[model samples]
Target: MGLIDSHAHLTFPELHGQLEAILERSDEAGVNQIITIGVNLSDARTAIDLAERYPQTIRAAVGFHPHEADSVTPADLHAMAELWNDPTIVALGEMGLDYHYDFGDRSKQRSIFARQLAEAAGRPQPLVIHCREALDDVIPLLLEHGFEGRRVVFHCFTGSPQEAAKIAQHGWRISFTGIVTFPKSTELQAIAREYPSDQLMIETDAPYLSPVPVRNRRPNEPAHVHHIARFLADLRGLPYDDLVEETAKNTRDFFGL
Candidate 1:
């Protein structure tokens, strides 16, 4: 079975126009499906359009990232609701807190996040969250706003094992990226090994975080996911194909692909 790049930015400018070639390379590298993420209204629409264009190979996750919290207008949320109803829109995020940069006001970010969580209250669609240096705030907010029974995956996970255990304990999933292959990311790799295999998944988070052996590479792409799969396979002591198949099944089941 081919692997899935569960979180990527194929709609981003750096990789957008070269999709055909990039997709070809991805296929050559054994990538089966990709989920492109959107962080704003324009991005969300563009992601939907891309999914429509490449329906067989791509899916969309639309939401306002915390970085853009202050700029989000009521009209934007209304537009997001329209897109969220589309059959092609698979998830509601790339949304959460980002205290690292704190690009937007923290209070606004929390409010916007809670509003979206309300919108997602009983929906079947999962959430693709981007949490950076704010798990303490992020975790509580997720509980306070009613995220108990929903599907949530923390994309591009760089958290410690304790944090991962808590997330897994809360019945949420965690997705790893190229970062796990880094020589210095021993803690993350440990989490990958210890986390429940059924609850674990992998991604490229394209246009970013290219793995080792190509750690210095620029504008990372979905084609590099195999490196990550292989890394995890070695770390977790499973065959490469087994790791791929397990993670692929996890992604498809999680997103209902």
Candidate 2:
């Protein structure tokens, strides 16, 4: 069964530095497509390059991470806007709120999010979102912008069923990561089971939130996506192979792959 690692940082130092081996392992595990996220200005270039060099296997998302919220400049957004046309750059995010660590000022984070959204206006691509303790603001922003019909994926979803319902109602997609495989992820499991398969996706979010049975490690790899897929299958009462196929198709459709 083929699967897509919908969100990952294969452009990052650790993984990108050894992409030959990484791609080999990912292929071995049946991970055919991956979305490389651009966390900041420079990251946009690397992700784009990676995608261009591996068009069939890799794609990229252009946005500034909330941690770099305070440093986001107009020039940075402009740079991302320029790369929007590179067929390899498929989405506009991995951007949103992150108040847990407050790596950057909260207000600055909000402004950056809005600015990126405005910059991406009229563009035909899904938004890769990353929200943490900011749904109240995040959800409303999407509504205010009338971000309907545009695919928006809540990457690494940590929200509840109610939140999932709201996002789903808006026609936005939700992508689950390795976190769902954790033992205390009952809430996530429940939501995954309830959400329609079309609105669902799978990602590794590698070098960050590695899935269970392997959470202790850092710099997670795309191959771990299989574990997340298995968990989702159990959650939805579907066979593992069937779930993989559906998620793969969903990922391609969500990102217009």
Which is the leading candidate under lDDT?
Answer: 1
| Local error of candidate 1 at residue 204 (angstroms) | 0.9
List ranges where model 1 is wrong by over 4 Å: none
lDDT by residue for model 1 (183-255), tens: 9998998888877878678999889999987888888999999999999999999999999999999999999
Q: What lDDT, from 0 to 1, does candidate 1 have?
A: 0.89
Cα-based TM-score, every candidate: 0.97, 0.95
Cα-based RMSD of the predictions, in order?
1.0, 1.4
**How does residue 117 of candidate 1 score in lDDT?**
81
Best by TM-score: 1
lDDT of 2 by residue, 1-257 (tens): 48899988987777756888888988998899988898997888888888889988998888888898998788977877788877777898878899888999999999999888887767888898889888888887877676875789889998888888877777787788988888898998888788787667889988788888788876799988988998889878999999999999888888888
Q: Rate the local accuracy (lDDT) of all candidates.
A: 0.89, 0.85
